[model samples]
Target: QPFTYTTAPVPALTSLTPTSGPTTGGTTVTLTGTGLATVGAVRFGATPAASFTVVSDTHITAVAPAGTGTVQVTVTTPGGTSNGISYTYSAAPTLSGVTPNQGPTSGGNTVTLTGTNLTGTTAVTFGATPATSFTVLSPTQITAVVPAGSAGPVTITVTAPGGTSALPSAYFYVSPPVLTGVAPPSGPLSGGNTVTLTGVHLIEATAVRFGTTAASGFTVVSDTQITAVVPVGAAGLADVTVNTAGGTSNPVSYTYLPAPVVTTLIPSQGPVSGGITFTLTGTNLAQTTTVLVGGTPAGFTVVSDSHIVVDALPGAPGTVNVTVTTPGGTSAPKTYTRVGSPGI
Candidate 1:
């Protein structure tokens, strides 16, 4: 009598559960299909997984190994290797910093995150709340829009195939600073003027600046007030900004008026005996009305808004100021030269 021989059939892998995870390791994946009882080895791409267990003739569970990019998964038994199944490997992304971590409650604000292993980011969340929009700019950077949230701080997290990375130490807040008012709209070039600012959320003020020039003196008086000394600056209008931990306030206009300017004298020559009618031209004149010749005040007449006729009072020969003033400001002094004989 002769003995008989027979061949066994090889099993095919039909599906796999949770086909992805971090390259650092530790992800249990389930393989499902017929003929899994005789599985010899489980591999995720070219890297073989560890601690694989056969649950039934049709199912097997294996822990994923650390790797990068995409790879083909398969099972090897005494019969042979089955058809390859695809699995993706990824690394957790990190966050170094978030530009402008604060935003409005209504949300919809784009923020940039910088760090490492940020490629293939699947999602971003703010304290468990999903972001409205997200984009992977590169392996080290990601852009995400803030979702609607309450006024407070919340942790930000990013998720990828490898796994979710550690939460960033820094948190994002919702409320921003609001500017109410600024004092002393106009100041001299010498600065040193103390201007009080009133606003909300001003306690964490970091810096104060007059235009682009940093202020010489600054103090946070309260959550709604800031006192700062204006730095010496040129004549013109400039914006005053107060920066705080929350953010920077809207720029306030700081007017820098030039010193009183002196133009020409109305009457080039006057009688040495005095009483000469003259007008003056210039800018930023003081509000007080007075006439002076070489700094000497002479009796003057207010003819109009821009002109002043002055009758030189018993003064010696030479020039004098024919100045006019109003609530708005003063006019520059005009010189009136006095001659021995009075002539126009």
Candidate 2:
């Protein structure tokens, strides 16, 4: 009688531990099936794997070779080749820019990132610190909440299955500004006055506000100085503050005075030779800085908040206008008749 002949059963693939990897692939995947102990080769599509190791008759660990798109993974043995399993390759993500790249060191601001191939992001970082949170909006965009950090520039990075990418000097943390003083802390209620602001960490100022009104204009003179034109507001105290990329500064007090008024004038008449003195009366006159008689400046002394003595200057024999100016504003003119001695 001839000896009986036998054949080994064909290998059958049950599943793959991980079904996907990067296009530049170097992923280790676990292949589970029967008759794997005798597995002689593992092929990903038509390309052979970088390496492989048969752990047992039902399991094998293999390193996938570099690949693109999707491909079929198969195993070969003396028994037979197993059924194919699907594997996908992903592309590496990129970073192009970060909007509003600068923020306060205290963080809590949302910033948008733009780039290519950004799907399935795993992590986002500022320097070595992870973002407070992040959400992927599209394959080319992501919105992330910033994390608190020290004041200065830091690199931003994103990680995905493909790999990690970084943008050097990408984001900056700024310290909030401080306010020490405001020069000439008072101005006219009508505005249009420039004031100096002194403080620390005042760079990159974005706004200067008086009470709730924004400054007409401003210039950053230095980290400790700024010249801002006041905005009109009601007569009273207004809080002045400066804003920068870091944050809003501490508020300082500012006073806005109402315009002065001229209600009376002594005698209301003076000689054309004009060596005569006149008493002027009005509200808000304590700050009187100037007195004009018919467009000509006259010497004056502030007697009180409601009175002042002005020496009338020589002028033609006729009625002339007299006005007063103070920090509040210029006053309405008053008639001062100048008479010629005895109509000769």
Candidate 3:
């Protein structure tokens, strides 16, 4: 009897992954199915793949030949040619927009990536840093977490099996405006003083606030500085903040110093006696540094922002001007009349 030899079974190609790549080709596709061990050749439509390696009876890695559009990919072994699966030649990716282009330096905000040919996006990056994570929602959208970064402008991009998006696609990593301190942190309650704010990431500040009052004529001096005309606020510690597209900064305190205003002087016509205690009534007198009766500095005590007590100073007088001074500056004087003693 003569011995009979049986040929190997024909291969059956079930899938090709990643199913798509750039038209320039050079994509390595994993071909999976039965009887792949002896894959002698791989064909994308009628064109042969540049190269192919059989990895197992059910796997082959084939380097795609340069091509365009979609085509059927197949494998052939000694047994026979396998069934065909589709492979797409994709166009270069394009970016349309990026949501919330600005985020914190620590980078944790969920940003939406919008563009064309974004399906199968393998990576999203800010500058050279990859996103924390990302999910492809469709051919035109992906959701990604911004990666940690230093402050200021950075370009953001997306990458797919096809290609990476291009630059000027704006992205910013900001350190929300910091208010380390303000020059001249205390100002007159009536405002109108130029104050310099010092900190980081102060570029393009949209608004400056002193407590609840908005600053006027505010200028962003640089990435870390701003100059603003202070706004009137109640006499107290006011919280100052800067706002930008990135975010609002932590507040720094500014104290509004109320200017003293003299309203009355008890015994406005006191005798020239140098030891008489005089009660002073005024607005914002608490910080009274001096009480002057006709150019004489008298001993004084501040009772409150609106009251003070001072001992009169001896003065040669018909009528003398009395005034009070505080950190906010001096008050207008009230007249004190002195009567000369009757001559003997």
- Highest-lDDT candidate: 2
Provide the lowest-lDDT 10-residue window in model 3.
Answer: 267-276
TM-score of 3: 0.75
Instruction: Quote each prediction's TM-score.
Output: 0.53, 0.75, 0.75
**Model 3 C-alpha lDDT per residue in residues 221-280, reported as the tens digit of each score:** 898899999987887899999988667899999888877898888877666566787788
Worst 10 residues of 2 by lDDT: 159-168
Better model by lDDT, 2 or 3? Answer: 2
Tell me the spans in candidate 2 whose CA falls farther than 4 Å from its real position. Answer: 1-18, 30-41, 52-61, 76-79, 262-282, 285-324, 333-344
lDDT by residue (1-344, candidate 2, tens digit) is 89987787788889986887778889999999898888889999999888999999999999999999889899999889999999877788899999999999999999999987788888999999999999999999999999999999999999876777888999999999999999888889989999999999887999999988999999999999999999989988999999998999999999999998999999799799988899999899988889999999999999899999999889898999999998888999999999989955
Model 2: residue 169 alpha-carbon error in angstroms = 1.1
- Separate clash counts for every candidate: 9, 0, 2
Candidate 1: segments with Cα more than 4 A from true spot: 1-9, 14-17, 30-72, 76-80, 100-107, 149-153, 184-195, 203-223, 227-327, 331-344
Decide which is better by TM-score, 1 or 3: 3
Order of all candidates by lDDT, from best down to worst? 2, 3, 1
What does the lDDT come to for candidate 1? 0.74
Q: lDDT, candidate 2, residue 188?
A: 98
